[model samples]
Target: MDRNTVEKRVRELNDLLNDYGHAYYVLDRPIVPDSVYDQHMQELLSIEAEHPDLIFPDSPTQRVGGEILAGFSKVVHEFPMLSLSNVFNEEDIRDFDRRVQAGAGHSITYICELKIDGLAVSLKYENGRFIQGSTRGDGTIGEEITANLKTIRAIPLKLTEPITIEVRGEAYMPKKTFMKLNEARDENGEEPFANPRNAAAGSLRQLDPKIAASRNLSVFIYGIGGDGSAYGQDSHSDSLDYLASLGFETNKQSKRCKTIDEVIDFIESWQARRQDLDYEIDGIVIKVDGYEDQEQLGFTAKSPRWATAYKFPAEEVHTKLLDIELSVGRTGVVTPTAILEPVRVAGTTVARASLHNEDLIREKDIRIGDAVIIRKAGDIIPEVVSVLVEQRTGDEMPYHMPDNCPVCDSELIRIEGEVALRCVNPQCPAQMKEALIHFVSRNAMNIEGIGERVVDQLYTSGLVHDVADLYCLTKEQLLSLERMGEKSATNLLTAIEASKANSLEKLLFGLGIRHVGEKAAHILSEEFSTMDEIAKADAEKLTSIHEIGEKVADAVITFFNNEDVLEVLAKLKSYGVNMDYKGRTRQEIPTEGPFAGKTVVLTGKLTILTRNEAKEQIEALGGKVSGSVSKKTDLVIAGEEAGSKLVKAQELGITVWNETELVDALGEKE
Candidate 1:
């Protein structure tokens, strides 16, 4: 095709793709299937590659994030992102309404919106094309996050008409995404995020755009950045409609109320049903609708007088702490749970709450028979917030954690650098049960039809004693268990049999070793081809590998040195379990290269490869990658906006190379 034909086709494709994207993302409606969209996108990408000069700033292809950034640059907002005044109760709402009425000398209309629990962001557009996005930093200046903002599919790259505008919105992660992220983090041996709001904030602040993209962030535009009159908008509600018309995602739940009483009703309705929504909301924002009314109301020094936020009262209840019960985990960590008097909290009847550990109990000074304030953390897990000291009576008894395991009467010991007490007894029935559950978990051996209920029944019936004994179950034995029929028993046996062929990493994790997690298991399995080899490795050998620290190495060595572990390994081998590591790690890695046998520290961020992807390639070529900079570092791979690690490398006189140099050394063509 000629240049003219290519240009015409590109324009057509862009229009079609943008419409489809807006429908799917902003509108939550898709006109075409994903496959159809992908096909058209492929055509667009091919044409753009062939004619790079024809690529426009708002091209759909630009959404696929390009480079990793070392750091975010600062952005100054054209208009100050003012905060709203807050109201706590019905009296405060009535007072605010009275003030507005007195100032205007007439009745007024109010717009109520759900105040989303998320990070605030400002998006700027020029000529109907998205030009930049920034965080709400100190209201005047913010960090540039254009690349990260682009990853949010709800954010449109181009508007419906060629109009310049700046909009403010809340960027948030949905509850489902937050749960999945925490689950993955737990499996990877990383600390779990406390709540969805924190997760969203951390994700948006990530220097790497790909990291932010993977977080599944979404946004809901609430208001224009500056004066609405410039856009020919008369009211806050009208501006919201205008934003929606421009293909921006706006909260449809926002309602225009004629009086403060209607606003109170709206707030009460949401407070009753807020949990039903997929996102979290901490409050309701009430704004005087008309721009003229807002100006007349004017601004207080720190907040807008025309707008106020009503924070929902936290759901908390007073309950007596009856007793503390202990439960042991698969890894032998014994956790204390508080037995509480039955009470209602956040629509659920609560009788128990996690104490976390003894430290929390001591910090709160909780006592048996004392009244404690309990609330659900993140509206999910019930926990004791604090003790109501004034409610304590003379009969209250100070609580103390048991020095022995509650299940087996074995002495408990606190491991070094750990907060919880552990029962090291290998024969503890509670540990055995927890280990069995972990063995069949989705992230472990992935054995289906074997849940905690089945594990409990099997343990109680004397059919399974340890992890190795799972393969020894018979059809008759399984059929005897409660709720187990012929079909279910057959399925359970099949799943158990299938798990025997899992890779060495799964089996290693299933064994319930102390400090070795799924990631460490994978690394050890890759370094050593067989289970016996890993078992035979000394602490020094384990510590020499990348990402394996002294504590983990010692834990691995201590676990494998046990006679009971040897017996279990032998039993598993006899049961036909695959003891050899079968993974792509070894076969895919090149043995010799310029990076081979070198310790590389990748600092800042690379433009091309993500941190994980770069680590894989380096490890594949026999190079070891460390997380931090040290004197032992052989080379530091620096990218744009390199930080302390790069400075440290220079101070230490260590070699440093930019991303291009590393790419050249790897013999890869640009």
Candidate 2:
């Protein structure tokens, strides 16, 4: 085929696929069958592969094709993405209404929208083509995530009409999608996300666009970035309609109410029916409809006075506490869990809840066989809200934490300045089991085919006593275990062998040293470049590094001093485990730069360079960029619309530099 003919066909295919995708994903109406869509998508993919030069940015095949990003850059919003003040009850709602009326000096129409339980994002378009997308990092600044956002089919790459705009939305995962994702995670021996909101956020923040695409996320565009009147719309409702007409997925459930009474009724109606929806809604957002009224009511430093959110009260259920169970963690901390009679709360069955510690148990006066009110904290963790002492019978037994470790029979000791009891014995079986599990976890060694259950089986069968024992496993031994087929045994051994090549940071994190988390592990690995260097460092040398405190230094010294730990290290070394940091080394901070050893705070909007670029430049010149202004702050770089941080810097007598001054200083350093 001729180039012109092929180009025409490609254009036709792009249009058809975009239209079909919009109908199916955004409007929830499929204009064509799944087979037809797949056929066209496959054709597009083949054509794009054949003629890479002809591939357009908005091509159907271009949605998820990008190299994994090292990190997200900062984006300053053209207009601030303000938050809404919260209204908990009817009284607060009525108070908001009164304030709006008093501020506007007239009656007002209101728009009520479902508050989607997901991440807030901003989408920017130039000439009706999607240009950039970002997160709501701080209202003023956000992280760029255009590649990840493009994977969401609900977000149109091109608008119906060519016009420049910036809109805000909530990106979310449907309940069905969330369940499927958790099931996949379970099968892969990965930790399941706590809620759909977290799943959505995690998916969007992925460095790889293909990962986000696989998660099947969607977005609901709620409002424009600035004012709706600029788009020739008089009110918020009208603006939503305009957005829908422009191929944005605006929520259709939003209602225009003439009175606060109608708004209250709408809120109450959704509060009961929220569970029936496919997605999660934490609350209802109430906003004054007319732009004039909203402008008149104005905004506070944090949120708009014309709008407020009515958060749904957490669902509480009463259940009988059957018994308290204890578990030991990798760090030997003893945790108490409450086994409860099965009861539904927040659309899930509650069989157990964490008691946190003995102090909480005694303070709440919790007893076995007592009726307790339970609720999901932030719609995720189930916790005991209160105990119904009046409903409790005399047969109820008082619960007390055991004095010894249940699994190892070791005496438990309460560490000074800590709440929970700990088993100091490093040889505790429970601790070893937990450590094995952590060693193979996603953020650590990342050995697939090994989960909590597999760890338990390995420990019980005496096949693995420590993490090092995992490297010595044989396929024959694995196949001897129940439900372990030959193929499964081979896969587990392969994964264990593969993990030996991981960088030093992964191994450090897997070791589960006290006060050493993933971030700390990475920092230590980068600073020392090798495990041996880290082990050889003294507390003074360790504490000299930024973000490393005396506590972490002490913990590192103690961990390296242990003979058992040294033996494990020698075994790992003998097994060919890599101990060198393989990741990119951070730039060294110069000691002789103009801003050397200075703590600088950047506030407001930067016009010359992005916030991230400024931060990098500052750090490159041996200056540390802090998020907030304090007495410790040596300098403040104030830009356009500098707010509280600027004022605080002035009040604290800190040296302040405007954008021009900052540019000059950077230029001098260069």
Over 263-357, each residue of candidate 1 has an lDDT whose tens digit, in order, gives 99999999999999999998899999987677567676568888899988768999899998899998888999999999987646789999988
Give all candidates' CA lDDT scores. 0.87, 0.89
lDDT of 2 by residue, 326-408 (tens): 99998999999999999988767889999999999999999999999999875668999999999976999998888899989
Q: What are the per-model numbers of colliding residue pairs?
A: 0, 0
Candidate 1's C-alpha runs over 4 A off are: 317-370, 374-670
In Å, residue 2's CA in model 1 sits off its true spot by 2.1
Worst 10 residues of 2 by lDDT: 584-593
For TM-score, the strongest prediction is 2
Question: In lDDT terms, which candidate is top?
Answer: 2
lDDT of 1: 0.87
Of candidate 1, the 10-residue stretch with the lowest lDDT total is 225-234
Clashing pairs in 1: none
Off by over 4 Å in 2: 1-115, 118-153, 157-218, 221-279, 283-313, 584-670
True-vs-predicted CA distance for residue 184, candidate 2, Å: 21
